[model samples]
Target: AAALISGHEDAYDGFICDEQSVPAAPGEFGVALDASLAVWQQKGYRGIWLKMPAAKAHVIGHAVDRGFEFHHAEKEYVMLTRWLPSSENKLPPNASHQVGMGAFVMNERREVLVVQERSGPLRGQGVWKMPTGLVQQGEDISEAAEREVLEETGIRARFDAVLAMRQAHGFAFGKSDMFFVVALKMEAGPQARELCMQEDELVGVRWMGLEEYLAVPFTAARPLFQKIHAAILAYVNGTY
Candidate 1:
């Protein structure tokens, strides 16, 4: 720490203290605060940054009470500044939600556009899998899924109906993520792959019949996908 400070004079435009130390308890935070203030004073530092992980809104409010303000970095985390008077970083007025969106893009003959992920933590890469995405801003899950199928597989789709919603919990990228299971009815023409590929995110996209999808094995979430398909079949048959 000494070497970093002395070796590079005026090197940092300003500093971001990702963390000063592990978070202290309710009363102990005052000690950390005093210690941090001392360091800032002695070092001739002009600004301080703090990171509040998770929904520590009470702690954040306390920090604001101590004159810290927060800025949103992304959907997942916030960056806080302690050099200025606090202001509200209230989450915007739009209602936010998370949902699973998926599709069974079947043609008149019942073929579907299936995509296989090429890389990353999930298995079944480069194999047959349904097109899917998470519902985003202004997106209804049903409509979001249709857009996902079209974006991932280049197949214009129409929904049959929602099939199911269930909790899918598993490890990927070294952490557990839960997803909602959703299914929809869809139809596409023979030219399903006529559009450009979202190549960085997908390796291959193709149309396959239910028998073919069932024939080829999937890795994680395979059972979930299979169940969605079965439900879609039932829905299309007027039984579900």
Candidate 2:
């Protein structure tokens, strides 16, 4: 009974092969699996996942011959899966991972904080954006936001809320980066007029009103710029 496999209604789509049901002997294991798959087909289950422990690695060859393919692996186990006859599965391509954090900060005057890079990808392009940087290992995202803002603008600020999250693959060197934008309220640490840009990275740092921020040709075209705009409105309305 596919319906009885789990309480959830979608159980008919797949079944999980139990580790306990794996026979120690190679011959018996194959025999048992052939019969199990036949029954699954008649019961309308579309696929089955087999989880094998590191200790039972010898069974990998037999599992592969029976149509199972590698799905994912962990430190202690490898998971193999197969689709039943007449079923099709669409799997995504493998990808790389990277993550970054940004800060959308505004002072009491409603002017947004922005930075111009001195080096790296957009050097000397005259494009202004919120202070953003890659998240460091063992650093919390919120902490990364605060650190990036102060490091670039020399203006201390406290994180208020997550304004938005945007991501894309193949951003650079065939890697994917997830960028999170956080809203922040300016604190009384550094004055904008005395801005201190980070050496070798930032060339300019200052505050600008929404109209001026969007007026920057490069800044207005960014997808996240619109999200920051809406967030600023919500923040000013006391509803963010």
Candidate 3:
């Protein structure tokens, strides 16, 4: 309400009431909408279209008093839009997923940017894998991906294409992981050239062929990577 009554006029097009967090009392359409619009009009606002349940028309009628008109109605919702002819439409950014985020470190490859971890849970682990990491709070998946890739392997990478999004399942030695199969355009070579191994965490970063990745003993992977590997190869061959 402060946004409507005290902010800049023409600052917004109209307000969208996503949730009726404040349900109106019975017989208060005029009391609610007209009063609200009057406050907004003072700021030079153009119009406001509120999507409320049709069952709440008594509260909507108040808007009609302030030049608000009915635009549409669906199920229990009625959309009332009032024009002040000056207000601009402003929308908030979409909410991010509630679940945690993660990314895949791709290498420039006509093939694959794979690695065999030197340390961690599978110590002396020679399993081929795509570089991936968990996103920390306040950090985007891409940012975390780059940081983790650099920390685990000395490879610097840019996210190319997203190949896969595995929900409901992923692997982790500590935190939960939401692996995004990202692509990195890279030339085939030694992964160690860019290896920034956190000696306590990883041992090696080896770039290898897709077939090699598939053939690495199953003992070197978590269930998530095995599936990711299958998905990746499907792309390598342009099959799936």
Q: Per-residue lDDT tens digits of candidate 2, residues 46-125?
A: 66777788887887789899899888777898888787766457433333667898788877777888898888889978
Q: After superposing candidate 2, which stretches have Cα over 4 Å from the reference? A: 1-95, 189-194
Best by the TM-score measure: 2
TM-score of 2: 0.56
1 versus 3: better TM-score goes to:
1
Can you tell me which runs of candidate 1 are displaced by over 4 Å?
1-97, 168-196, 219-226
- TM per candidate comes to 0.53, 0.56, 0.44
The TM-score between candidate 3 and the true structure equals 0.44
- Candidate 3 scores a C-alpha RMSD against the true structure in Å of 12.5
Worst window of 10 by summed lDDT in candidate 2: 1-10
Cα lDDT, all candidates: 0.59, 0.75, 0.56
